[model samples]
Target: MNYQTISITLLILCLPQSEANDEAIRLGLKQVELSKDLNGWKPVTQSKQIRYGEWTTNAPIGQVGTGGGWGNWGTSVVWEDYKTVTSNEFERASLNNGENGLRIQSIEPFVPSNATKYYQEELGSFIISPRIDLSTTTQDSLFFQYKSNTKMNLEIWISKDQDSYWGIWEENPNRFRNHISATVAENDFTQIKINLHDLLIEMGQIFCDNERHDAVINPETNEVYIAFVAYDNAERRLGSDPKMIEIKSIWTSSYYSDGQLQPAPIDPVISFDHKCSSVTISGRVGETYELQTSSDLDDWKTSYSFTLETYFETYPISDFQNTTMRTMFFRLKHKP
Candidate 1:
């Protein structure tokens, strides 16, 4: 008697599952906020002059009226043509509260008492990360810790394929923001973990005309960088409490699924129950899975999808028995 084994695979979940004892490589600024220093990380700005100092309302000339101008008030940073600075030649950007991590808070528009047109000033900063190396990873996941005001709209952008600047990317400049805001309480820090492949899939759905796109961390990739831009224009409203955002750390880990490092595949246990004419599959309890079937092993179709309430699931082989087919194969897939 020939018995076929059940196959399993991973599915993306809203919340990531944890695998015990997995180490992560710290990404971006290496605890800069913990040390109370911006380090190599800097806020995006227009003027190269105002690098280090107290956050001010001083807007440089040619940066006031229209083109990149918010009357020199607030942070002189904009989404379009965003640039980053490093090295002593550039001024250092300032954050609030050394004990509370790197906080970039919104400010009231520096409306000069004599100004004619108040071109809605930008209040918050768009901090960019230093060039990150993803070339070493075939697939990876990210873990980060941060907090923000409820009204704050945090946006993220990526630069890949050796882009010259932080805001720039090889293709598709679309922005990506995870649904972490729901879990984050006002002014309270929350930590989140996400698989990069899953994030790329989400980005492709939202940005690429609803088409599936290729993963960004393949072998051909040369350079990659991530920018955490906190510019909630809604937070700029007058008489509203100032909106702020802060970051403590960012790190990446090798790909894993269902609390286990993956590609070290964990196969399911299968046994035939001839007395009942059924097949039993034993796997980690309380996990969701998709059951698929194939006739020629080339074309597969989903037969059943469900979550396990127990350590084992049993099904009548008659459910999948085909009269005309001599051979049939079944596989079970699990999503983390």
Candidate 2:
């Protein structure tokens, strides 16, 4: 049998935008920074200089009435401290071992009367003025512990710009919060991984409760703030409201430098070499292609390419040299 060699090159276009976003989300999760142990996470109250329960008097607050009482509610809380540690306190506190956890002991109280009378004392009951940097390439995960006995209400908010223009991203209006319950015991840590993109999606859902929503993507500026607010369903005492719940630990992991979704690396190029009667093709394991042969070099004929099976077989051609006289060339054209 006489053998003639023919070589062909194949080119593939870029992937679709949706496929790229999916790949980015997958890789971004894998590149999480600082999966710290929960044990290493110390409470924010541990800072001696920052007094505990020093609530601000001018913070923004929100309220939701469940049935007969203020059991299920939502509000934003804010505090000012001179210490650098607490400056970005919430973000810093979120960086803990996956095993470490946080829980809500009690929720801040706010009575919502049908009347719009100004209650100066209740004005700033809860305020969260978080500085969200759109520039940061970090993926943050949060875990909030809640008792199974009580109804749990929670909400998270984010602002691409500043708190003045903040908006809600995730909320559990009246449903019991779902958490990774532990076998160890009550009050132990239960974790939830919240990606930045997820945060954006959740916020979009909140903004578009009745319509469609879109998430913004810009890497040039810092423009987002995040907030986590919870409510207690337990009854209150005479002397005081339920002791404010404590957040055990908050964890964060840094991601791709740009902080936006990215596409996966391009797959290796595929090419084939045909020796008239014999053809050898090289390609990535998962890539697919279709081989072809031509007599006039203008109109081509289809042949087999790589498949799930180890190697692809082509039909045997008789008189390789004589066939090439009529069919002079062969090429591998990738299938769409």
Candidate 3:
């Protein structure tokens, strides 16, 4: 309750404040974290080597040849007797759910210049929505796997709204975005990681494609949406052949921090009063160190550089400078 007691208490509080600020600065420079496990993220479309809707649509359509039967012009089959050749080709196949109301189409391949046949439809399209979260402590990372029987290109869209009205993410227009054209190995699941910071830097606007792009940060409400489209243009040796693509998985994970600052696999030991001089530099192997000297703590100068060797080896300070009688403050920036 007296002045001495009050002064001591204030000093203790001030000490913690300085330490906290220092820790913040250290963490702010670099931060990275990896997910412990990846699961639960949903995929819009997941198929195997089968062409998009080929197994059910094109195959059945091919089975039922162009409807025409033996008949004479003069004595043609009666209109009433003619059975309506119903085709259940596409009906049996699974179609896109249209959650985001995004439209997908299959385009026929353009025939060679010499060929009389017009372009034949062979490719299929679909959309995928990757889960993402934007928060101070929680960061989102996206991973997905894709495989194709034939070479194909994947296009992605990111939006703040479900409707196609507002265009938030695009590749060709030179708008802020990031896309990688990966040549898929035959039937292989390609894993990809989408870092939150990288996405924001690339996309000038956050959740621009969503209706509430600007509101993503509001505590009351905010939403971000991402979609993907795939196009295949494999040549068909025979007419009515089917092409296929399969998306294996789509996943997202959260970590303790901003998803940066990886922890070291091994523990490190600490030592103090390391003597460094003009002839020698004292430092431990596999560690970051700073040689600081000060007549007063207010002003300090770094005299020698510290570097770790390949293997754990003792470094002598005799090579850098001669230790003077005065005390010097030397510290190591032990980054974990």
What lDDT does the true structure give each of the candidates? 0.46, 0.35, 0.35
- Candidate 3: deviation at residue 92, Å? 14
Best by lDDT: 1
Q: Candidate order by TM-score, highest to lowest?
A: 1, 3, 2
Each prediction's TM-score versus the true structure: 0.39, 0.30, 0.32
**lDDT tens per residue, model 2, 1-336:** 999898878898965222112333543322212235323222222111212122323322354354545443443334322311111122222312332223444433332332122212111112242333333354333333322233334455444433243433234233212321222323443334444545543443443443322233222124344455444343322233444333432333332233454335323332322322222343332446665666787887665555411122222233122443553565555567
Q: What is the C-alpha lDDT profile of model 1 across 151-232, one tens digit per residue?
A: 5555556644325323322111243344222235223656555445456544434432322122222221223556666654
lDDT of 2 at 26: 47
Quote model 1's TM-score. 0.39
Q: Kindly list the per-residue Cα lDDT of model 3 for residues 182-252, writing each as its tens digit.
A: 23322344544444445543343333333223322211012345555555556533353545444433443
Off by over 4 Å in 2: 1-130, 136-152, 164-186, 198-221, 232-244, 253-336
Tell me, by TM-score, which candidate is best. 1
